[model samples]
Target: MNYLLIENDKCVGVCDYEPNVGNDNIQVITYSGNIPQERLIYVDGKVADMNNYTFINGKYVKKTKAIENLLNTNDEAKHYLNDTDWLVIRHRDQLALGQTTSLTNEQYLDLLTKRQAARERVVEYGE
Candidate 1:
């Protein structure tokens, strides 16, 4: 299975390893080359400790609850928008004219939350 090599709360790289077959120690192959088991913390991707790290797509990302929540909420909001009539010309016209759009309360809340989260990210990242 794939694993993440962590040292000092930073991801060193990714590697493959099997635990407890014949040896307690396993060599982790990284971009820099093979790293000894004693020099890194190996986190198995199968049972991830989400409090520390998260495996996203094909890479390991550090787990930050606030960022995760923001991303999840944004994805949900985008999905809802895509699945609804929000993309229709009539809806755009209504929004442009300051008329009541077809947005549901939940959708509006999700958008609001996403906006707040984005602002927070901008402030945090100073970009």
Candidate 2:
């Protein structure tokens, strides 16, 4: 059986066996033949399901991580901008030299448009 080492009503960590008695705050809850994942709440001597739940006022409540998702989207947008920045620079360099770019004008314009949109998303969604 795996042991969940709880401290101050929170599952601080897991242990393979009951630890040597010392700290009173470190309570041990036994899991019968199962290993629970992190962020699972132990309430009323039972483990809650693996979901976006938070312990509030001695109970678990479902929560949505919208800001986290928005931040992730912003990060993805920033990455896209970084990945395609060279293409925009190359287009400008070729334009200044009056040389034919590898990409057509339409393609270059599309790239610019997409890059602008990515920047907008980063500004709107990022921290």
Candidate 3:
């Protein structure tokens, strides 16, 4: 079982072993599942992702993503780059074969522009 190390109302971290420390501000909760890095652990052992929700008045409330938190945004950019890389490769291979590629020059340029923008965003908000 995984244990959530909750300090105050926030889930500070997770541990596999049971915590035996004596502190009024610290609490632990156990569950049988994969706990994400940023998650909220309720007193009843319910867990919620911090990215999509916020704890308020002892309940989890839905909220919009904060712009300052760019880790997820950077990851999304990287994913976009990786997922569309095959299109570029295919375009190159078709050109080498002296055949008409499925992707037009305009389409290829658009993809390149979008990929460049994604890369720039990742750099601007680096991990």
Candidate 4:
């Protein structure tokens, strides 16, 4: 999900890079559409600017982000905030409704047994 990000002509930075083993600095990497190494800029521990990146119009931009911030969002700010307790059912029959998720081992087994029973039907014979 690496995107070529640019700030302007003054400075350019490629966030897409590999970390150097010893230094905190990111190794300026060259990939398809990557800026020339000499043209890239970095200051302190971060890429100070990102305006010189080469990109085309209408290209969807993306970036590789640290995983730390992924789970930091609250339920409301999150995209799909499902209730931890309620089961989501598409229909209303025994088989129509699905079990609430997060089942334990025993619960899962019980669900399987119930599912088997729900799928069965009584048969009658007439004289």
Candidate 5:
């Protein structure tokens, strides 16, 4: 049976075997053996309970669905932005001259309409 090793009321690691002889100085054989008794406070439940937590930084932290979703969303957004070529446009205002930058799809569409109107003016005036 699996056992969770607790240190200072926090789960530190997991062990496969519980000590056979004495409970006073119990030895838990984890992936990394010879964990000192000073760092080991107690042993928690079996494998079923251990599934609720993830081992991180020598401690078992509770895993949440929300945190997982947020992490996945961030990864997907990074990939999407990297793969896609976003449109860059310059602002038309005289005050913000000499600045060119990429814009989102909505901003690009707005600028596209203005550009089409300017093209129409050039065609009609021959300039």
Candidate 6:
């Protein structure tokens, strides 16, 4: 399945690959450019191309269903200082869903800009 990279504002390849966790059920995943499999984020369920990737701060873990909502939001991009922070605290007892690396705010903004340009081009061409 294809997933949207909210940070990069581009189409990223995604798959339902499982971690070494032996869960038997496939976890939906998002694969961004050069982002190692171990470093990508996995949330339960699937997302359409319209959904977005977000960086959430360390504050919202215990809030039930917060992660799901974060992924589905339109304009807001949540973030944590480091990717590991979310993994460690959120997925501690559970099997490691996947791996992720830190993406700086500047890097993320650049991605959005690119996405906007691409959108503009599509509109111009009437695609």
Full-model lDDT for every candidate:
0.52, 0.73, 0.75, 0.36, 0.46, 0.38
Score candidate 3 by lDDT.
Answer: 0.75
Error of 1 at 45 (Å): 14
Candidate 6 has what TM-score? 0.19
How many clashes would you count in candidate 6? 9
Q: Give the TM-score of candidate 3.
A: 0.46
User: lDDT per residue, candidate 5, 13-54, as tens digits?
Assistant: 655776343463334434333434433333253222444554
What's the ranking of the predictions by lDDT, best on top? 3, 2, 1, 5, 6, 4
10 residues in a row with least lDDT, candidate 2? 54-63
Across 37-108, the per-residue lDDT of candidate 3 in tens digits comes to 665555345676677664444655556556435657777999999999999999999999998999999999
TM-score for predicted model 1 compared with the true structure? 0.29
List TM-scores for all candidates, in order: 0.29, 0.47, 0.46, 0.18, 0.26, 0.19
lDDT by residue (1-127, candidate 6, tens digit) is 3333322322244444533424433433454445443334333332322323433442112233655554434222222223334433553334355544344446555655655554443311111
Query: What's model 4's overall lDDT?
Result: 0.36
- For model 2, the stretches where C-alpha displacement exceeds 4 angstroms are 1-64, 124-127
RMSD of each: 11.1, 7.2, 9.7, 18.8, 16.7, 22.0
Q: Say which candidate scores most in TM-score.
A: 2
The Cα RMSD in angstroms, rounded to one decimal, for candidate 4 relative to the true structure is 18.8
Over the stretch 11-88, how does candidate 1's per-residue lDDT look in tens digits? 455657532334423343234444444424345523234355554555556668875786676566556555543445
Q: Candidate 2 on 9-115: residue-level lDDT in tens?
A: 56777778877648576777888755555665566677665465644445555556864566577889999999998998998999899998978989998998998
